[model samples]
Target: MAKKKATAKAADNLTFLKTPTGINGLDEITLGGFPKGRPTLICGAAGCGKTLFSLEFLVKGVEEFNEPGVFIAFEEKADELALNVTSLGFDLKKLQDEKKLRIDYIHIDKSEIEETGEYDLQGLFIRLGYAIDSIGAKRVVLDTIENLFSGLTNEGILRAELRRLFQFLKDKGVTAIITGESGEKTLTRQGLEEYVSDCVILLDHRVVNQISTRRLRIIKYRGSLHGTNEYPFLIDEDGISVLPVTSLKLDKPVSAEIINSGIPSLDKMFPTGGFYKGSSILTSGTAGTGKTSIAVSFADAACKRGEKCLYFAFEESPAQIIRNMKSIDLNLQKHVDKGLLKFYASRPTMYGLEMHLVAIHKAIQKFKPNVVVLDPITNLITIGSFSEVKSMLVRMIDFLQENQITVMFTALTLSTVINDQTDDGVSSLVDSWLCIKDIEMNGERNRGLYVMKARGMQHSNQIREFVITNKGLSLVDVYLGPDGILTGSARETQMLMEETGQVLHRNALGRKDREVLRKRKLLEAKIESLKTEFESAEEELNKIYIEDEIKRGVLNKTRQQMTDLRSGNKDI
Candidate 1:
């Protein structure tokens, strides 16, 4: 019976151990959420998204987790809070009417309220407790706890009551989130972090190059492992979205299926006839080097394969991109019309890097594309620092690759060399890098394409001439001649010159063959003449011998006539 009781106690403790904040990536960073039944202090200066973070925690607990929540607002009123969050599509009023939530605004103005000596916050405690019990709340949020100190004159009472309030919430077994203003030297204004010390999260808002970025950092989380790095978060229409800037575990499954790169010539470059599915492809080049052309080709190819594609253009409008792609015969508008392609055009300066990331996230969730393309990612550098851009891109790449989405990014380089490329510095992070360069020859520039890296795949090493004709984009072998690698008119001129040389060489070989045949004929005639002459000489010699024989016979016949004994003639 004692063992059974101890087991039950352990189970109960485990049940109320941690609560998920329901913020997008916050729960993952916290390793679960804030400690259950303990107060977590969220401190920041004005407009750092502190209140929104806490409100979201409570609202999500009620809506998503089905846990009733109590919101004791010390700054904004119930109506104002609801009105403020309506834009975020959080129907706070509806949640309250459904009895799943309770919002009580406790306004404490320093000028309106006069604090008497030796007074405790028993009234505040009663209100909070009644609110909690009325809804059977499991989550509580005290937004801007520093406001409570504004109406207090005695620091001793304020500090003591603050500690007691936290303890009371803990005693009630309700997970609480306390918001406070950031202090100059401390984590929270009025040192509220010193009291409600279970976990402390600090929010920071900084401006760089006239653009604002919000960051969230966990100052301390006692008795738990949490992400300590500063994560860039955004407070947009969707509420707080914190991007965990840690290197994600490289456990995402790699795909073996090869996807065509759209251009047949380009596809032939890869040994697999295409790129690996869910791999990141980077096409970087200088001005007018066909970076966008290559990206559009990829998107067109994906769409032609009946896969959805999302194109994020930072420097061009949708119409502009569509129009420009038409010159290359990509026909991006047709894909968009068929709903296989989606274009999202926006300026990089329109929002901070985090907000842009959030927007992209939202778009991805909505579109659920199989492929994503970002044209001219270098424009993003104008709005953010190099490291910031790299971090956001890393998070995005990790997310996309994990979801098995093939991503293509186009970066514009200021120069031709790879080392002096764009500051985005995503070259090493990508799976395949296709570098486009301007091949200047014969006082003209032509585009050349080469694969700098393709992880886990064999690709072509030779630079091919990239041509953008009205028919489509094509890659041809760059002409290598006596001078060097040739392109443009030089390549064509050299090609013609080589053809002419081949014709001349063929003619010379034909002439030599004819000359050899003629010499053989002449030599055969001379040998035939010598044989005829020798035969005539032999015939003449035979005739002369016959004549001599006849003459000797006649003489012998005369002698035989004289002496009839012809035996001598027979012997002769």
Candidate 2:
């Protein structure tokens, strides 16, 4: 046994290697690319971008990886294939001239090809071998293997030939990508090629609410870790870009600096200066509760700080958003002109939920914004289930936080539902929650803002009155007097009534004091007049006494004086 173990086999056994697909996100989803030295089947319905994906994979291998590739098209001509990918900036003819790519358009006539007994597709193999050998292709793409079945109707011969083709490709040690139209129940039209191949990818093009979205899912990739989610893919000028739905677990430290929430008074409520950088702030309220306005104001604040911000408006167009923000006194056009703000407006049902996420992700990547605003995330619920939307938000928040980008999401809550549990299904994932409510008091609606929670920071628990004016968003001090939270038109009425009441009380007190003073002055004048009369009478009596005394001295000095005069006359 030891002697037998001493003998080692040659190390020439084929090992698993990934070939680059040249697509943006496809390599990440496939864990590098498809299995090297093996065939991969890509199946989907018509107009699902199967042919484009195949061509991108081959061209990417040739141009990027420096690996020669062979594109064997069964349906399309060479000129048509070349013209189609020109928009993607891929020049197939140039690659062929450089001896890096070999594109062979196999024109098969179904009526002419005779399927005899015990026949194999040796001619097809010979053609593929010639093309691969001509350029020494390390990567091969066979688009629409089903076209072979269409030309040859014999099932046994077709299956045998397909198995032989797979074996032939494997022996050649070339990584091949095979594309086919999707079948109703199987992975591919024939189903045999999918099983024979080492990898399988399914492409889907669906129109939900009139907006078409293309999605890619890896059904199976043998011996490789691949994403299973339906990734959103876009066919643009650069070629097909797939957005992987999974996230990596890299521990990136986030900033703790407090960033403003647009409204200064609102920012003052937070004890940590403001919300933490990379935090998720949720503003939820009933319709017309200024949810979108708050979100826009936050974006404006970020723009003022010279930080790039992105505004994703699902319910309003960019022009309409600008118009509405102007009414609130937030001039977003200035920020747009300064290159600080970017607005992306689309319908929630414009595509599927995944497509929306991809669009946002791509925009964020392209803009590298510091702040991201999603006005009324509830609109996303229109296209997806509650759990689906929640899941998407969780992923999105995680992505933003990982990138250290602050996020503000607004949600429109319905008044018919009472309770926090009935929120728009995204409140639990937020770092800060601001609930705006329309309180009906004194027969008028008032806007009240309250901080439900601010994680890792102390915040005021009191409900603050908020107003949206032409200047911007402001938090009026809480009305602590008789009236609570004076807002809307009622604030004016309350203020007017308060002023009138104070004026009336002052006028009534002034009148009472004036009346009391008038009566006191009348009494004082009467007493003084009486005293003057008494004094005058006393003086007159004194004068009369003097005159009588003089007359009584004349007449008793007038009586007493008259008595004295009488006594003096008697003495005389």
Candidate 3:
């Protein structure tokens, strides 16, 4: 399966004959690199990092790709370039000593060289050829080819010779990178000299809102499809790193494993009992809404799970974060000591957005954490525009998800009214979004947390009261009464009042029940008394009738003597 996948990838990439540049993130954007054995023109303004880019390309070619390189510097000496790049950890002298690289500084002076007759750059060609043959170099870099215009007086001859040089390099079958100074109207300061190359990459250094940013764009690439979007780049201790803002696809593998949010109540809010592994979580809230506290809880939980975590604190120093977490009963220092937690603290203004991103990328590559926490990503908005910040976040989230690393980000919403939204515009890209804010009701403000959205899980829609104590953050049920939701001291007062009312209601119901029972018993006794009186009256009547019969019989006997034939006697 692995081999089949590899074959498929190869087939996808077979459209272009590319030579990998070995620069982080650049090769991916270019689909592989510059077209093989083709000259690519790199033009940019002064101090825009054109030189460093070409040098790194050649160096990487030698060290990584096993392609020997020849550097012909027409601007600076070999020693100067080497000294400038030493900090980037490139051992130029060592590479040269091993015959894997060669640096030839070509000095030109208008006063020293005169174009007295029609002449081609045959001597220059011989020199470059010798350097290439000596080291069997497969890569060549011509630093600022425009120097020929100053050295030679004839414009026609110089242009023709320059074209010949490009043709010669192509004939040599070596991938070459030619550096040029940027012009205001053209891709290079030398009007039409860059047209000879098949690919042209332009670098720019721009400052906006007092912050500096570097960008790269490809003007043209012949016979190959390339990305035309302007990519942000950064130059730091490592070297030039281009951050491509595109290629955020949804095809990355997702995991079914769930990771806890550290707070049991908060975890219970989600149907999965936790967040999905490799998912992006955005915690957005207003000030003092426990965004950082929530992020720290996640870090603590990850460390306790025996997983490594990276904490990026843009708003606070490491000491401040550690001390603040301690107050919440989160002892992050222990995790740091145990090598399970790493903290990278820097003010968001310390560098441009691209530099910060590059630093983060390098850290992740080096540390290989299972979880990453960005405490308060909203602070980055001060350095970049909203769209730029969103793009950077999208790229970061994409990278982490591709690696199956769960990431958490905290954002601050300045206004209480916008509590349901995110400030940096990255909320839509996250898999789970938890929004927290102050619920000001009954003349008091209390923290409230709710899951604004949790994709692929049935999350609670009720807003929970945020409670942070010495034991960390927790969610309590909000006070839902006739007056609507209440929190903080107001909720406490409402709860107390509700308890009192419930007690009184129970007492009243008990009294009413007892009264009803008493009335029922009284009615039963009255009916029984009536039944006894009726039975006694019937018995008296029966006795009277019996006595009457006896009297009548005696009377009838006496009357029969007088009237001889009383029917009564016969009847007797």
Q: Specify the highest-TM-score model's number.
A: 1
Off by over 4 Å in 2: 1-15, 115-120, 153-155, 206-213, 248-252, 416-418, 483-485, 489-572
Indicate the worst ten consecutive residues by lDDT in candidate 2: 4-13
TM-score of each: 0.83, 0.81, 0.81
Better of 2 and 3 by lDDT: 3
lDDT of 1 by residue, 145-167 (tens): 77776777787887899889999
Q: How far is candidate 1 from the true structure (C-alpha RMSD, Å)?
A: 5.8
lDDT per residue for candidate 3 within 163-217, as digits (tens), equals 8888898888789999899888887888644555588898999887777888899
Could you give candidate 2's per-residue lDDT for residues 2-75 as a string of tens digits?
Answer: 35323311222444577778788898898888887789888899999999999998888887899899999999
lDDT of each: 0.87, 0.85, 0.87
Q: In model 1, where is the ten-residue run with the lowest total lDDT?
A: 563-572
Report the lDDT of model 1 for residue 36. 76
Candidate 2 vs 3: which has more TM-score? 3
Q: Can you give the lDDT of residue 37 in candidate 3?
A: 76
TM-score of 1: 0.83
Compute the lDDT of residue 305 as modeled in candidate 1: 97
Better of 1 and 3 by lDDT: 1
Model 3 TM: 0.81
